[model samples]
Target chain A: MTQTIIWTVAILTVLGLLLALILFWVARRFRVEEDPRIDEVEKAMPGANCGGCGFAGCRAFADAAVKAPNLDNQYCPVGGDEVMQKVASILGLTVEKKAPQVAVVRCNGSCTARPRTNEYDGVRSCRVKAALYSGDTACSYGCVGCGDCVEACRFGALSMDPETGLPVVDEAKCTACGACAKACPKHIIELRNKGPRGMREFVSCVNRDKGPVARKACANACIGCGLCARTCQHGAITVTDNVSYIDFTKCKLCRECEAVCPSGAIHGVNFPKELDKEAVKKRIADRKAKAAAEAKKEVPNG
Target chain B: MGKLTFSMGGIHPHDSKFARERAIEQLPLPPVVYVSMAQHLGAPAKPVVAVGDRVKVGQVIAEPGGFISAFIHSPASGTVKSVAPRKDLAGNPVVHVEIAVEGDEWEPSIDRSKQLVTAIPDDKAAILDRIKACGIVGLGGATFPTHVKLSPPPGKVAECLIINGSECEPYLTSDYRIMLESPKEIVVGAAIMQKVLGGCRCVIGIEENKPEAIRSMRAAVAELGYPGIAVQTLKKRYPQGGEKQLIDAVMRRQVGSGGLPIDVGAVVQNVGTALAVYDAVQKNMPLITNVLTVTGDRIPGNLQHNYRFRIGVPLSFVVEQAGGIPDTAAKIVSGGPMMGKAVSNLDATTVKGTSAVLYLSEAATRRRPETACIRCGHCADSCPMGLEPFLLNRLYKAADLEALEKHAAQDCIECGCCLYSCPAGVPLLDNIRQAKGQVMGVIRARAAAAKAAAEAAKK
Candidate 1:
């Protein structure tokens, strides 16, 4: 038994030495000479491999950052300007700050204004729907109700209001990726300036199909009759190709476009001052009275 | 030869090619046509003709506004009634030249004969010029100008060219029909593309279901004795026709995240593109019309018709020719069921990118209720471009542009693969698209700023 134990020990020693020699050979022959800068830059990176920097992964981005002359436009959205500065410092380049912006769906063609016409029966895809034809609604310019915009959204910023068949974008969740814009063949779901405090006023409808056709399609389709431009006190609106476009930079969030739009094509978000419900009621009454007065005027002056 | 395939993230939807048996037929010309100017994927074309001007079929009405844009041509000889804005399929009122059709008179320069011509252009510049003059854009639903794709940007070398014959979308067999009927045209077109791309190695990729097409394509390649240009059979998968996917399958090169196929030393052309190239280089014919499948036979009342239509023909008119809407047809889509747009207006005219018009019965198109993301990464796993759709969806919900860019949400191809694969029917792509635009905007602004800084430094 004692002899057998010693023999076992000797065999074990030989096996251990063989394993050690194999390890040593592997370490020496197949060693990786990784540049320390790649590791350092990678450590500073967001490591999301989101390809926003046009690289496959964070490591690749780090390598690119090291090789590039500057981190000029290579700001990582996840990391923001602060993370970019660190990367720039490592690369001996300067980084600049950019304004944070989110995606804002301009239109508000909800179920209240935009109603369904025919039902769609195919692959429940926005792209397929958009590729096939206008959606299951009278408004060819509005959302297809198929959720292609929602499907296109990579940032979960947009959602379809099941009650409305229109997309509702969460301002805070939006990342301005433009995937939805490309996905939307109708191009109604636009990514506009988020602006300060999420208060923005822009022409929501993209339908430039003239007054009569636009009116027939959607109750709130933009007529593009230049009423919004005329109503804008700040010369910030432009009328071209039967479409009204508002310059958000120049126009303050006055919501005049919303008030003046005959079809309510212009939309607003987060108005601080509560809209006077009584005033709106009064205005509608006054407008009816004015219409009655105008009709009376149109009658022969007998 | 072994069957080849583009790797990863493709679905095999039902190939409901009910109209496959139908031979290509010419649709009766409508009394009126509204021709769109911006048919290609670039700047909107500028209208050169005015209202009240008489024009012939295939006559240029709008000129290219940019290098990437294509010129607009009249589909029929007619008197220009109104050069005004008309609602397109997407509800965008583009500049359309409204023509009151007179007759089927074509432009005098065009040879209307059905004789097959095999004259190849002598030089690369001549071929490119011919293609440009023809206004040949990708007939594969992309509408990218063929000349632009053939002519790579300066310093970028195109080592390989791929012919995309994979008609991966279900119910759309336009390319398949072309391959089966006119294999020679496709082959000649491919050879022309190879020549224009400076003799790059070319491969024709056809799906396995199309053995007849593959055999025909292979036969055409052999008889032609075109060295390096070969045919490859791909696994049938939805979106296999996608340029990136096709390139990957053929070259085994992942076009890199946020990079084009051209970046990987490959230029992928669609089967329709090859036909257009052949027409441009060999026949000197411009791209004013294409083949489209108007299918719905499986549908109770839908017509299954294969049509060769001119650009700007109204969907209403096309549907009317296909025995009108199936009395049971609920929705009229402009393309295949998988990626097609549901058009509300039949008045909207066909553009260059139109492939098929599907009138799905109510049973085929009722969208399922959208539910919460059950953390099923089907969207991510099925994404052709390798995007984390769930993560993007979350960032989009938060309006976290920084997180979106950090996650590389901008790389999404918007192919609806994520949305299609979701078991819970989550609209992952819809929300992501908005964020994508915003991120792209930020990127563009940064680029502009960098450019401005660089110019300032130079000064």
Candidate 2:
């Protein structure tokens, strides 16, 4: 029995050494040469591999960045500016600092604002509901309230408010990856700049119905009266398709447009104080009066 | 042969045909009729008339917008109230031509006489032109232009024409009433279609539950002495009237995925569509009316009706005329319970293919709480297209597009068979439908890319 045990050990040891030698030879012969910077770049990444950078994963992004001439198109939305700075430093490339943005639920058609026209008892999916019909409310371009954004959110930044039957965004948790915006079948969620001190003004409604129809459908629907557009001194707002849109780049945050909005569709959030609507309204009226008087003088000269 | 049925998975929902024996009654004209330009399956028709214009019944109001679209004729003689966008039954905005009724004056070109013109015209092109001119579309709950179906594309010869008198969807008896009332016209319509298809043999397939329809159709065929037209009794099964299923039931041919019914040398037309064709060809009357069944378990016996309703009457008006919605009604479906659209707006007017107004009670229609899939194979068993809905649902959750393609998600017919038979009450059809749409989009994109590549290679 002792002789047999010795023979078995010697045979196994010999077999292992022969296999190791073969493996070493194969590895050396067929080795693929890859850039060493790829590993460094990947290490600098957050490694969530969420494809938020428009690649397969963090490794893919790293490989592309290493091979790329410059990092102009590669932006990791989830990693934001700081991580991007690290990546840029490692890659010896420059990346423009993009403004941090958050998803804004453009629809304010709460249960009370937009009463249910019919009961939708189909699949509890916003995509399915949108495909099936114009949703439970009369406003076809409002939030479906099926929480598809919540399901698509990778960071748990969205939840459905039961009382309002609308999605609420957790500003702190949102990475602004735009997944929620993409998931919204109604295209109601928009990625806008978080703005200075998180104080920004935007239209809270997306309804494009005509004035009477829009008002009848939802109390908060944007009637597209062009009052807000006329009130903005910086030409930041434009009305198209019966809806008003505020261009964030040109917006001055003067809160004049918000005060002139008759339907209360324009929303200014995270302000230090509640807006004094009467004073803003008076200011707008005075400005309009001055503009009208100047226009009258120009008309006489022409 | 023994009650013929498709040799595949199908369900047996209780055929709640409460109004099967109800005679067809004429519905009185509403004060105003809102005729939608999107009554058919393709692009919305372009309106030709303006507001305040006088329109006679059967006068063309809208012209076909695309090759697959049908013409729209005014249903009532009236003054045009508006030519604007209006909400349809599903609450989607569709362009409608609203007409305030003046009188029942018809276009002089239409023959309003009731005399049956039995002579089959030999000119195929003329027949097709007349059918198109009269705006006859299939009334099988899919308002496909009938003229398009009668004319198969080149190199595809129709071997058999199946007249779908099956009326297989539960709670729907509109086709049955029409078959009982206008059996001769339906036979003539089938013969006309058969002649259009180079004199192909025709088979009228009706379910055994509709024996009276079968008998009347058979008698009509005999009396007309139409060569090569016969009526076959089908097994009572849900969705047996589906085009592919009917072809399989009658011709024993399986339509390949993403293929048309003509690929199998079989062309199917609903019984109501055949009557419409008969009216269009013989009487030169445009399709402006159809028989619709108002039925439900909760609806009182006297209130249930099989009414020959003019297109563009509001559904709410019809319901009001029939003693209003029942208190026990929880949902109003615009077709069969299996695959009907829930009525979101009763104010929306009826279109050509509006088959029934089914009011299902809460106990009968509400979804039960979902449980974990026990893998009983019931969904697979009931899927008439032979798809595994449970597998599709799981893959959809994972968003695995490749696996979904391999499972042929695009072939799903969305008949709700899987959801109807699932023991777990899982929303199988819902997920599968979404998956199917996504996969189909991918497939279309791939096809377009390949076409572009081929063209580039040629360059």
Worst 10 residues of 2 chain A by lDDT: A45-54
Winning model by TM-score: 2
The ten-residue window of minimal lDDT in model 1 chain B covers B296-305
| lDDT per residue (tens digit) for residues B226-304 in model 2 | 8999999999987898999999999999999889999999999999999999999988989999989999976788878
List of clashing residue pairs for candidate 2: none
lDDT of 2 at B245: 94
Each model's TM-score, in the order given?
Answer: 0.69, 0.97
Which lDDT tens digits does candidate 1 get at residues B1-459?
A: 676665667677677767677778888788898888877898888888888899988788888899889877788888999888776776656778889999878887786665666656677898888888888888777888888888888888999998888888888878888888778888888888888888889988999887888898888888877778888888888788888888878888888766877888899888888887786677666787888998853564236878888877898899888887777676777887777777766788988888998877767766667778899788877887777898998888787999999898888777888888888876676777767888999999999999999999999
Model 1 CA deviation exceeding 4 Å by range:
A1-209, A218-302, B300-302
- Candidate 1 docking: what grade? incorrect
For the record, the alpha-carbon RMSD of candidate 1 to the native fold, in angstroms, is: 12.2
Query: lDDT of model 1 at residue B36?
Result: 86
